[model samples]
Target: MSTVHIKPVPVTPEEVIAVARDHARVVIDAEAREAMAASRAIVDAIEREGRPVYGVSTGFGALANTFVEPERRAELQHALIRSHAAGVGDPMPEEVVRAMMLLRVRSLAMGRSGVRPEIAEGLAALLNADITPWVPRHGSLGASGDLAPLAHCAMVLLGEGWVREADGSRVDAGPVLERAGLRPITLSSKEGLALINGTDGMLGMLILAVADLRHLLTMADVCAALSNEAMLGSDRPFQPELHEIRPQPGQAKSAANIHKLLQDSEVMDSHRNDLAHAVQDAYSMRCAPQVAGAARDVLAYAETVADQELRSVVDNPVVLPDGRVESTGNFHGAPLGYAADFLGIAATDVGSISERRVDRLLDITRNRGLPAFLSPDPGVNSGLMIAQYTAAGIVAENRRLSAPASVDSVPTSGMQEDHVSMGWAAACKLRTIIDNLGTLLAVEMLAATQGLQLRLPLIPSPAARAATAAVGPIAGKPGPDQFLAPVIEQVKRLIESPALRHEIEEAAGPLA
Candidate 1:
């Protein structure tokens, strides 16, 4: 297995995906261990002096002023983990749990968390062993660093929580660690607070969402171009000159991508100079780049936030190089929350526009000469009429989800941590938005390809041809529909996978 090393330098989105999604092994860097030891020495001094620091010698949150006896500090850390592992829902997917664990490990490895180097090494062992703790889905307020989710993860370190087996069944962590030739590490001093005190869950989802959206964004352009060709819409709107005056980076890129996809097409060329066919296309067909491009810009902005966050010291009472332990608002998660919410809003626009194109494809009045619903027998065979409905349904759901989660903050932790970021909720709903949009686009691909096949004599653009072939036999021939749900699922799999986008990019040079 390939190993991802945790260094003090800022990590990349790819690294997080590797450990989280790809199940790659993780190793803490040697320099990070040295730095952690130095930081631990400082924490040790504070403990020795009984200085009543926020997390080291004192109780947490509402109990911060209450002093913990020296011998009881370890018990304090243990109790903290047990109390905070209060997440309540079905377990989060293994990939998300893995990402959260990796992010927490990365934060601690930065040497500012005042944790023993062995603590980090222990977390690395769990990751390397794929001993993912079962983290419940709900209960994060996206402030104080995803406390509940990370605590469930931290519980596994003390052999207290459940870890998932190969088949996703839960088992005791103690036995799992023993089987992995490992022993659970006992938390000491500020270690427990350090483990759970960061925005790992929200940040992890944000990074994963960014990665997923990149693929879906490419698929959106491909489907839009397919819709344009299927509907016999003019490609003039996607010309570089039209986008240059406005010149939003994402808009220009989407325009260029659509241009490439619509280039060298028999369908486009047949009517390239025929003004008699139509004057202008609908907004869904003409403004494809504008919508998808805007989403791309939102995605880019989110990436900037995720990048900076990867390099951030998100733990509370972050230990500085000069041995100062200070309480800061670094763990608030507002920045990440807002970024995630913005992306959700942008993604809904992309899906909405795609939904409109799907509607145009099925409408006899709008779909040029294609039969109603693209059915061979318009009345007897409903054909892809219902696919548009599916797309519309998903679009409506996405609209509701696109409402910003960052602004809906509720007070948490007895109101001491008021105005919570709700970033976790933002991140969670964004996942669904990205997914539903993909399904919606899959429906578009289904109808667009069926529409393309109906325009049989005039071949689609080379890029559309490649993507259509990738969609398989269900989209290849236009006839009475058989099991529309499975067909949509089949194309949804194609959309979820890289095959469609890969084939399109391979045929067309590359999407932005």
Candidate 2:
């Protein structure tokens, strides 16, 4: 058999998402090796000189000043894992655990965490073999870099606890590795510290969120196009020149996207002539470009933070090139935490406005002569009425979740761990909010498409028409109570697909 040597691979945030969603293997490269060596040298010097490093040579957390004997350092490391693996509640879903593994591997590949090369190799190997440690969902303050959750991850390397195998079986980490023909790495000086001391958990969730956010933003544009067509609203709000005068990047881009999606429609110019109905539509329909545009702006800022974080080494006691080891708060999750909280609020608003559009479509008075709830049978069918309620419920929940987690702080590790960022909470809530938004938008897509069809035989804007066609088969407007969960999942698949998004955009005409 030919040998295929696996080398260390460079990772980007997008690659992390891909690996999380689709079980992809990971490898390390030559460049990563060099960086690892540099970090190891600094850590080794500190160890040999008997200098007290926060996590490497002393007790962790509030007990940082408590020193340990040299011989017991390994035991100390193991103890840290056992004690910090205090996560409670339901275990995280497989995809999230996979995301954590991918993020941790990429962080080590950056080669600044002072972990042994073999440690990184073993972690990557587990991922390659699809051995994901079963970590709990709830128990991180998001300060000091997701310490509790990551400790569970590190414990699996010690062959001490249970993990999920490729086939989704929960088994002991030791036997799982044995069956997979992979050996666990030994805990050494700063190795355990390196593994558990970072913002990988929060960052992993953020990577997934940002990717989904991009999709939702695109879906927002598509939904707006459909609403515009259904309402037969004037397209003047999307004029490029109108946004140019205001000069907001997101506004300009969003308006351009709307203009492009509606460009080829014969119905648009026909409706532009002083409408007998009123001057312009409500803010939800006419100001779709502006409101959705703001979300794009916050998402851009969140992306920058995530990209830089992927390349960063966010552990305590960083090692420098000149063989100097310094204890610092690099593992602090404030930056990512605050950004995630902001993104939660912004994305929550997206769903909030989407529900409003759903309300308009369902209301008999405001729906421009469409049947109540878009039902052909009206009171007999109650078509899409409860779906609007579901949408409203999710949006209300999002509002509650939108309250910033970053603003709250609780002291842990005694007073030493004072001023926590609650970053993990922010990331977790953001993930929930985004998922809810996806379902809400999916429902909106179904509702708006039905409204468009009722006004049928009247051609819609090219972009809206194409999106409707793409989602038609996935989430068709069925009669009452047709098991919407499956249909919601189908629409989610469409939302996640970049190819479908591009196709819809292409049909809309060139992006303005």
Candidate 3:
């Protein structure tokens, strides 16, 4: 699909990923153009009127008291970038760097940061040419605008650093700019502060994380249904009318997805006979909707925060339309930081519940008709027993990692940057949790599929049947203790593929 054109309204996290992955071009809107013009006019007035603004005539951060002469202003901006480009860690993935460039362009397009037009243009050219800067993973408090990492970005604009070219070659920005016929930007007034001070880096990571999580959530519903069918658990918990009374959008949506994924199967309808072994199944099966639904709720709120961050001109000393410069704390990462941590907590639960289901599948007493290790030769061969151990270990790790990152802070920048959001920590940690959830889900699929195969002749719940149809041909049933790793790997790919992901999303839509 072609990328949607955005005006002044904030861009959603999903929109940011779609644009970057699909190579969308961003254009400045009329209002944004006027905002840019007003900012530029104020800057021109500063240069002409000889007004002493914080960053325009003075130094940055702890060096605010030192003043730069008018002749040295351009040199000062260049020096600011060179000195602050001290980010040290592994280089960020290429896609993330591209998303950062896209986000930086969108933020500048809002036109309130007093940056020159070429600054935004340079970013756009990089996006078009697929030039990704080698931004590092660490060294940001997620306040003061993700200083170290963003400085690396700004350094590329001056063509004084290095960037990854279209074909993955790292080239010096100076010669590349000369070859591309582009000029190095000279910072004017608040431009350096504008370029470096904002939540773009954290926001970019969150956007990609959220987009991938949305897909993973869809995969979770399908996997949960498969596990549900393998156990022949009652489907009474997912009645649409029951959820309709309270009507949280996410809860209602999850219940509906469960219903649709099981709609055509004979297995769900066949078990209407109330043979009371226990009145109902456990909470892991019964409360899947509630747990999964709550995550969706947090995701909705996080999307709002992500969108606002994308469009906001978050630099300090913002140029107001009335031609006044106001230094403020809009660059703080608290909102995005907390949201990322909340998302990690929410996503972590999906893995937690799925682990319980994996345990249930392996327990012969709990699993009813399935074999002790889910093996045909129960006593001799230990089949899928160890799979649960792997899932358990992953779930425990996720629990430890889900601790809130926003609650912690340390002083920096001579204590001026005291109470940072730690949003980068939140973003990176959440990315790990999401990946772990994927592997956990993959493990469950291997075990559940094995259990269903053992419970042959007796049909599975309707949702399980559909999931088997979706994944069975791709990964056939294992035999005689063969390497189950390939089966788990295959199921993970099926769960993650665009086709199966779309099917689950369609199932989720009716509840909305």
Candidate 4:
């Protein structure tokens, strides 16, 4: 409930995520405003000298050498924003737009963008009011720091573009600013360019994706263990001694979680000495910890990149401590793009492995004694057969989504930016991959929980019972086919919630 203060230093990814997703209010710290004032003083001194500056006294991109009269500089900045407000496709989710605005303000607050402190203050106020700008989905090339999308955000600050109202309607921003007792920002010489020239958009998406994957990865372990138990397979692969030698931290953590979840299972004890069970389980069941743990490590690396980016000053011609304004390539988004793409591939693989588990749960030949498609009645009901189909289709889509978006780029701005990062594309596609992964995992959870249900009097491990109990309200018991989409959605929401983790941890202790 506390306001997220904008400090003079770099912000944390947690703070950015809070502001974006939680609607946490923000206010600029006085020290950051003072820093901006000092930085602005340096820019003011330069403007009076009449020497050409890349963004202050001259035009942008390929027109860097073109000069405008002192009287036309304000017009130049506004014109720049208008021309760059060229994004196409649907509006980005409100959370992404909010995060982008917050990051821009954070960069300006760092005293590097030569922006007036008021610019940051006005943005903070808009964010506090939840007045989200309409940033179209496609625009950023990732090299120029998501210019077009950020430009749309900057246009909203100037009351020139549309903003999403409290009722979720897109309306003119001028009246919204006024009704909220806020005034439109009047761009000074460099303020407009200052607002748009940063890697906020792609970085914002990367941060959100990391947050989502952390939870989903943990859930991946939960579902994997449930499948192993439901299929009547051995949990020996999750034994700590088996994984300690390899010592991949994520793998160890996942193995420990599975080891804990499989404890107290009467089913495993039911067939322990019976040679009827397969000597070894399929890779999906036995190698669950390996693949999911690798994904956990991938997310850790991506989180490191996200944290570094959060603290970086990602703008061109940054105002330095020594009163120099020098053009730099710090705005390039290659780092964020690479992180997004890597996480995408990892998430896709995690989903693929989970889909295989779902297939095993449904296949009569493979499910040991469970019914075909996990149906309560074989021929009378189709059961979750279609759910496995959904998982397979989603897994296929995720594989395509995992292709590296950062590996490709197109020149823009008349070749002034000859090599683009395409990181925004990478981050955006990563969002989709994570979402798809979430849904596919939901199917695994659904089918696996139903498989646990069919086990009946054969008691499940404490962790499996707890995890299934968390979704029991909607998932119910194994029965004739019901509408599966709503149940998948319900379980998806539950998987993303704290309740599942709380219950599972209560029984299995904290998951890694």
TM-score against truth, every candidate: 0.98, 0.93, 0.92, 0.98
Runs in model 2 with CA error above 4 Å? Answer: 1-10, 166-169, 474-485, 510-512
lDDT digits (tens) for residues 1-512 of candidate 1: 37798887667789889999898888888898998999999999998877879989899988888898999999999999999999998888888888888898889989899999998888888988878998988989888979999999989999889887778788888888888898888989999999999999999999999999988998898889999999999998998999999979999998899899998899988887886878888899989999999999999999999999998989989999898999988999899999999999999899999999989899998899999988989788888888888888899999999888899988876778878899999999999999898899899998888888889789889998887787757565888667788888889998989766777888888787
Measured on C-alpha atoms, candidate 3 has an lDDT of 0.76
After the best TM-score superposition of candidate 4, give how far the Cα of residue 178 lies from its true spot, in angstroms. Answer: 1.0
Q: What is the C-alpha lDDT of each candidate?
A: 0.89, 0.79, 0.76, 0.90
What's the ranking of the predictions by lDDT, best on top? 4, 1, 2, 3
Query: Candidate 1: where is the Cα deviation over 4 Å?
Result: none
lDDT digits (tens) for residues 439-466 of candidate 2: 8888888888888777766777777677
lDDT (Cα, tens digit) per residue for candidate 4, span 322-351: 988999999999999999999999999999
Preferred candidate (lDDT higher): 1 or 4: 4
* Superposed model 4: Cα runs more than 4 Å off: none
Best by lDDT: 4
- Reference-based lDDT, residue 238, model 3: 87
Off by over 4 Å in 3: 1-9, 12-14, 28-34, 165-171, 175-181, 269-271, 274-276, 503-512
